[model samples]
Target: MKATVSWQQALTFSGKTESGFSQTLDGNGETLSPMETVLLAVGACSSIDVVDILKKRRLTIHDCQCELEADRAEEPPRVFTKIHAHYIVSGDNLKEKDVDRAVSLSAEKYCSVMLMLKGNVVITTSYTIVD
Candidate 1:
């Protein structure tokens, strides 16, 4: 739950999580920006929940990928106003209802990052299952 960032010169930084994972972030477009990281966090968080939920239901999930599209406000402090999460799921005997329910549960209950941004961000989710 905790992370640290060190300056890497010229608006760039190296961030390390408590789990020892590290990433390079830069504001000059050389790497992932802070805002882009946030978007990624949201996508990753929800994807984890979706995959886990499906597995727990005894569904054989071969692969899961999420494509996130976001829109930010035009003015300063440009924060995300809308986010669309499109999940492409590949598995055996994956039911549409199950996928829909999994996504709904993640958005409404499981995903912490999505819950945190509930009010400020409009989040929408959809999924396509590949047999």
Candidate 2:
């Protein structure tokens, strides 16, 4: 839960996590901006929940991908106003109902990032299963 950000030069920084992971962040479009990182965090967090939930349901999952589209406010803060998560799931004997339930559960109950932004962000989800 602990991390540090160091100035790298000219609107760029290096972030190191407690787990020894690091990433480069830049505001000059050389790397992912702070806003882009937030979008990525939400997508990755929810996708992890979806994958875990499906696995717990005994579903045979071969691959899972989540595509996220977000709209930000026009003001200076530019907070996310809306987000849509489109999940592409590939597996054998994948039930549509299971996928639906997994995504619903992740958004409503499991994904912390999604829950944190629930009140302010309009979040929607959909899925396609490839057999």
Per-candidate total of colliding backbone pairs: 0, 0
State how far residue 104 of model 2 sits from its true place (Å): 0.2
lDDT of candidate 1 over 21-55, digit per residue (tens): 99999999999999999999988999999999999
Candidate 1 residue runs with Cα over 4 Å from true position:
none
Runs in model 2 deviating more than 4 A are none
Tens-place lDDT digits, model 2, residues 43-100: 8999999899999988889989999999999997889999999999998899999999
Residue 131's C-alpha lDDT in candidate 1? Answer: 94
* Model 1 per-residue lDDT at 79: 93
RMSD of each: 0.8, 0.8
lDDT of 2: 0.94
Range of the 10 consecutive residues with the lowest summed lDDT in candidate 2: 34-43
